[model samples]
Target: MRQIEYFVAVAETQSFGAAAQSLAVTQPSLSKQIQALEADLGVVLFERTSRRVSLTPQGRALLPDAQRVLRQARRFRNKARSLGFDTDIRLVAGVLPSIGAYFMPRMIERLRQEMPGLKLSFVEGSSSELARQLVQGELDFVLASETDRTDLARRDLFTETLWLCSTPEDPVMQSDAPATLSDLKGRTLLTLSPEFHLNAIVARLAAQAGATLSTEYRGASLDAIRQIAANGPEVGVLPSLYALGEAIRDPHFKVRRLLGYDAEHPVVFYTRTSSPLQALNARLADIIILEKQAIRAERAPQFQV
Candidate 1:
């Protein structure tokens, strides 16, 4: 079981040293266990060079099963500990860019209140990358805006509306509201990088509006765009969820509902299809759904997706 755990950890971390640190073991022992597991399985699980380690094809094929075994082992241990012993659970959660800002703190607070002994770690990245990590078994649960169905089972966390946001001081903000994309033909826009779904939305919206939108800068960080919007004449397209606090507090920034932009940006909580975290995933999912609705109820009148 330790060998299986070690193998999965190595695969998930992509470095033996990092896996050892995470597992709280020495590198040599972790390597020994992984070697033993490879021998028992009769396959080379990883291609290790001096600088890095990568999974082999056979390793990729066996990774899901190996992860399942480790999860079961963990569950069994927890079940035993529940019988008058201590059952401490460690959870690794991945999150999308925008959702992490507000939702994460609330979720973490709730988790601490419910499970005082829980050990939590978080990783934030693009929704697609986070989804891929979920599929790869690197994360126990992921809060994401887009669901990647490859190897994950997702529960809808919430849906957020999107809008066009600009600095109040900008001349365009004073102009008549844009009913169509073409209204801002030569406007400079700030948005997420091309790899993110929001960037694609901005592109398509521009094409439809017959506007030649030029992105001054593109990145995954919403704060960066907000800063640019605050500093320059760039119009920003952002999720209403992210733009809310700024809009409310800053006199210079305002969000305008994008006409015909009603699309469900489905924030989902995802886990591996077969893992012991399923029950925990369900609990987290319930919390997310409830909290998301509460958030939307307060802001929905002013926001549109």
Candidate 2:
């Protein structure tokens, strides 16, 4: 298990020094462990050059099995700890910045009220990063988009419609009509960094519309992209809740539904299939879905225009 841990750390970081620092061990110790593991398996696990380190085919094949073992071990430890006299529960969760920005406040409040004995911590990152953390057992569950991993359990939570947002003075906003995909032609589209699922969705929309996605202004969050869109010429692709929240408060921004484009982004909750916290995680997911549904119901009238 220790050797497998060392190998996984090195594989993930792609740098022995970085992996050693992350694991709080000396580089030589990590290297020795990995070397011993390779000897035991009788195969070279990594291709190490001066400039970079990459996993070999043998390592790639074993990586998922290693992660599964680690996840199960962690779950066993956690389960044992939960059998103590303390009835309190601790959960670590991950969420993408875009989803967190809109839903986190409400979700936190509800959790505090409903599950007072629960100790909750959250990490924010891109959807892919969140998924990675979940798979590695660092996170108990994740609120993110659907992932391709078959080892994780996923439940569809809700769908958020994507809207085109621009400064009020932009020609598309002034036209007194909903924007269409073709309306974006030759225009600049700004979005979150490519690691975000929303960015891929926006890029596809741009490609279909014959618009240019601006690589020069990749934003770290929805707010960052929204602020950039307020400067004009460049438009933003935003989720309905974010667009409505911003547009209602800031007269400078205008949001319109996109015509002839499928703009729904499905949000889902993910947990390891073998998680010991499955029951509690499902309850938490239910709370999130209920709150999200309530918000959507209340705000549905505002978006009708």
lDDT by residue (105-158, candidate 1, tens digit) is 766777677666666678888778887787787887887765435667767666
RMSD to the hidden true structure, all candidates: 17.1, 19.1
lDDT string for model 2 (1-305, tens) is: 89988999999999999999999999999999999999999999999999999999999999999989999989888867763312477778898775676778778778788877677778888778888998998998898875667788998998777777777787777664668888888898887788778778878888889998878676567887877877767898887767777767776567887765656677889999988766677778788889988887877776653
Q: Pick the candidate with the highest TM-score.
A: 2
Compared with the true structure, all predictions reach lDDT values of 0.73, 0.81
Among the numbered candidates, top lDDT falls to 2
- TM per model? 0.64, 0.67
lDDT of 1 at 220: 82
Pairs of residues clashing in candidate 1: 161-305, 162-305, 182-209, 261-305, 262-305
